[model samples]
Target: MQPNQFNVDAANKLKIVSLVSVGKHPQSGRMRRADQDSRAVELGLKLTGDNHSGESLVVLHAGDPGEPNLRSYAGMGLKSVRVLQLDPAADAILPLGQHLQQCGADIVLTGVRAESGESSGMVPYQLAEKLGWPIVPRVADIVSVKGGVAEVLQALPRGQRRSVMVKLPFIASVDSAAPEARQSAFGPASRALMDIEVVSASVDDVRQAWEEAAARKRPKRLKVVKAKTAAERFKAATAKSQGDGGKVMKNESAAEQAQAIFDLLKEEGVLR
Candidate 1:
């Protein structure tokens, strides 16, 4: 009944593919295995665990096969990743959809958005359109697949969730709410083979006309404080908002000023 455990017949019969991309570290901009894509790979591995062969879950990527980060997904126990070799400027939806049709894939998993490049988060949707498969957006987890129907959890606003049943041959975009991926083992990553195949592709004319520029870092959004416990809820409901008054600590000692700033942070729950 657990997410990691599945009916052997259902798990073995269904074909699942996870599409991954090169991820960029938020601060460093270093390339790595994408976060949500890795979670999709993790879920794919979980589905294959009951069978023990890991052959049912196929990891696919449409880009350079030699990309070092692609092996990171293989480190999570995937034997190999099927890479569709194409020009970086080419749109992947056509080839990806073609491959899925050729492979007779029943379930397709993808990240909500790529960590690099245009990051429009439209690959899954576009692929679904091209393949004529239903798409479940922002999937938090794939609970089970039975009778050609897949029970899934969808991530919603404010930490809420929805359970939906999608028929077979569907696409689901993995959300950040999904389980965190396991650590990538270096040995497995080093040994994992990149199965690359050259495919026909066309450069996107629409994308070519767009202007490109460096990204500017934006200010971080304040974290929302959730009140779950009864006491916490009561505190949240009864607490009075601070006044519009500003305090000046011009005459305060160095330690007092530091303590005051720390206390302010604690009051704002930033320290916690």
Candidate 2:
């Protein structure tokens, strides 16, 4: 599906919202505009541009309104970004869902996952469930919208593509394979407004206990040996694992062999 190929009348009148989040640099650990979320905003821009309509699309954020990085998102030719002010530890789902449900928007776009925090990619799914709207996940682009139905192109594994038709008032998670976002300009970004709204904060008890830290790879689990009979069990237990490039101890004593196995297990962190 190519860009700018949607119905002009529908595009002009279409109410769209794109959800954005603060992104983190993988190496430097600095905040920036999220990648997939930026593409979502780009998609929304194209949706309105199809009809040469301006300001028909609304950009939204659920966290801090004062974050300097948010202006980068506004730099994408957006007039302002509507923000739902909440405590850092509060959950965004409740307020976001409530706002979206009452906003009467035809389409809601978001990234498949955030670059910061948990990055579980559950926000779109949870928002869809909250509003009782069907979601089209990993969508590369929306081909067209007509007759209250949207034809969307979904990104599949191995560079495959699939087309799905979803009704209006649906949620879509933009894929990384979607069109790259436009470069942000400093002039427009500086002049754009951060429209903050007053909202009651709902603390997220679950996230309150979260401790962010670096990740570590886990040890590969050893395959379990199964046997039906006692003789089979003994044979299986004593049998050497079938793999090339492995150390083999054929003439070693029982105690020495047991010690070697114990050391290997300890090195692998299989034993506490």
RMSD of each predicted structure: 8.9, 9.6
In order of appearance, the predictions have TM-scores of: 0.78, 0.79
lDDT per residue for candidate 1 within 127-236, as digits (tens), equals: 98888889999998888888889899999999998999989989999999999998888887798778899998999999889988878864343445697899997786
Specify the highest-lDDT model's number. Answer: 2
What TM-score does model 1 achieve against the real structure?
0.78
Q: How many backbone clashes does candidate 1 have?
A: 0
Off by over 4 Å in 2: 50-54, 217-272
Point out where model 1 deviates above 4 Å: 50-53, 218-272
Candidate 2: minimum summed lDDT over ten consecutive residues — where? 46-55
Measured on C-alpha atoms, candidate 2 has an lDDT of 0.87
Best by TM-score: 2
Instruction: For model 1, state the Cα shift of residue 71 in Å.
Output: 0.8
lDDT of 2 by residue, 113-197 (tens): 9999779999999999999999999999998888889999999999899999999989999999999998888888998988999
Please give the range of 10 consecutive residues that has the lowest summed lDDT in model 1: 216-225
**How well does candidate 2 score on lDDT at residue 33?**
95
